[model samples]
Target: MVLRSTRLRLHVGVSRVHRWLALIIGVQLLLWFASGLIMSVLPIDRVRGERLVERVSPATLDQARPRAPLDLVLREANKPAREVRYRLLLGREVAEVELADGAVVLQDAETGKRIPPLNAAMARAVAVQAYRGVAPTPSIRAILTASTEYRAILPAWRVDFPDRDATRIYVAQNSGRIVAVRNGTWRLYDFFWGLHIMDWKNHEDFNTPWLIGFAAGGLALAIAGSALLYFRWPRKRRRNK
Candidate 1:
């Protein structure tokens, strides 16, 4: 009798929600599982156009030159920034400035002028950073934006540069050699960063809290609908053979 009763209950209680629940849970689980799998997968060195620079030896303290002061660089930027930090490495003698807007400039020690910059025709060579179209406020903003380049982050470290790249230079701090100097093209660095901030699957972005909240609303509606169906609605059954 108890077995018969239990069978009767299970027959009535088995639900469409449970049927679909497996599907929903499976999909969510797959996403989380994929995220885990993505991490466990080997870290790839080669990114589309850009190649990762191999780490080089840092110079000894005596060999590295003294770094220019934060005050001097801040003055050079000449803008109200969100933040600034600088580290002087005597070993490398390169001044590395990382701005919030993501401008990295390595300056010469003695002159404090920008090093590894593309030389323009006559007067505006120093300000050629604008033409790259990467900087939100490039050096040429004085001409283009009619204002100084907006700076958000100042360079964090200054190492020495042994030489400059005539057209391009994104050098490594330790070795003071170009890690990625511009030959001509941007190499499309911005698109990669955009991918990082935005999720890979959908460009629209469910990672955004607002979208999550919308999803939660749908979840609430589903729960409420299920509760109403379970308790408030009566089940009427026809006799089976």
Candidate 2:
């Protein structure tokens, strides 16, 4: 009789813990399921803004065009170049020189004249050429710091298009390269991704303390519920002869 009482008390104690854990961890579990379902339903290409924008092909270098020798251009720059690349920027051939100090210098390939950093107008032009959607004149702004939406490069241009998707394109200021394309679809997907990962801010980190604590609680709940089930299940009684 004492053993049976001890078992009943143990069952009650485990049941209480299980209920508390369920109350605490149930909401997050639902959020995880909902976010996962939404993400799976959304097409990945639209989320990446692939249909809204097209990649700008690399400009072909014209050998027939009269251009200054690379050696002469490097000598005049007088900077220790970690790397150098030649590309056409808006029909003008230019040499992009990356210095040891991580600064990028653009020089005219024909005249070797130093090109200044891209201004707002130049950034807008780049964004326009890369964008495939038919939208009105886009609002241009400079993103000087890293953000959750645009994190690829610093000092980039954010060209906002007034379209259905609210498309935004990011262009690297120095390289004249389209870095990232973001739209309303991508934003929605990212929001759900943040919820799934339990990272409300930044939306990148998945190893937060909140996630860890909830995972531990969920495991405890499972164990306690299993114990309760084992104790409560009815056993077959022996027949009286």
Candidate 3:
């Protein structure tokens, strides 16, 4: 009976230690958890912080090895822009700056829309990114912020008067017209996404210690806990009676 009582005390002692460790480390883990939860709830626009606008889609392209020349692309793109802002080297995409409006245009070389087929090995993703535009390629493919124009919060702001064109515009490189503009809800969404993309800062601070510290700590905690569980925890000395 005495031996059994001693064994019972040992078990109770281990259980008490386990609870104490859980309380201390569990609180720290909870902090990380709470921060992560808050981060998750942070609004996308708040995270994006900017109405990032860039010309990502292509104008006109073919999969043919020897793609049509610039002149041919321009001709197919029809009207010309004052500036052909930037060209995407991968996946057929082009941007044109309209000569008259000084607006940007994005077109798919193949589809002439803002987005192209996903180059995933097995399957092809559809083009929901293909929307009207000075702001083309509205896929979650990437976050965008613009310089020439502004993104307004409408429906949210201009509840009485909803003007789509005034919010966000996607210009066609060839035509220079506001092909697709999202002033109200569209603008709101893009702006939100921009925030979600590093609060739309688009700077070099992505890797700063301030940002990575929490993640690194969490990683360390996870690794340490795993090691303890595998090797050390089970063998820990029992608490003093």
Candidate with the larger TM-score of 1 and 2: 2
lDDT of each candidate versus the true structure: 0.38, 0.88, 0.40
Please give the TM-score that candidate 1 achieves against the real structure: 0.35
Q: Model 1's lDDT to the true fold?
A: 0.38
User: How would you encode candidate 1's per-residue C-alpha lDDT over 1-241 as one tens digit per residue?
Assistant: 9997875565455444545544544454454456445533523333211232222333343335565666776666554444543323322244555556656565544445455532222113222221232323212111112111111122211111122211332323222332332321222232332243334433334476643543554475467457546654667989998
- The TM-scores, one per candidate, come to 0.35, 0.85, 0.28
Query: What tens-digit string does per-residue lDDT give for candidate 3 at 1-241?
Result: 9997876676665556555556555654665456556556655543332243223454445445443355544554456556454344334345443444553445544444443222321010112232222433332212134332333211111111122334333432233222333444344444444333323453223465533554555565565556445543455578999
lDDT at position 201, candidate 3? 51
TM-score of 2: 0.85
For model 2, how does the per-residue alpha-carbon lDDT over 90-126 read when each residue is reduced to its tens digit? 7778988888888778889888878878889988888
Error of 1 at 62 (Å): 3.9
- Return the lDDT, model 3, position 205: 37
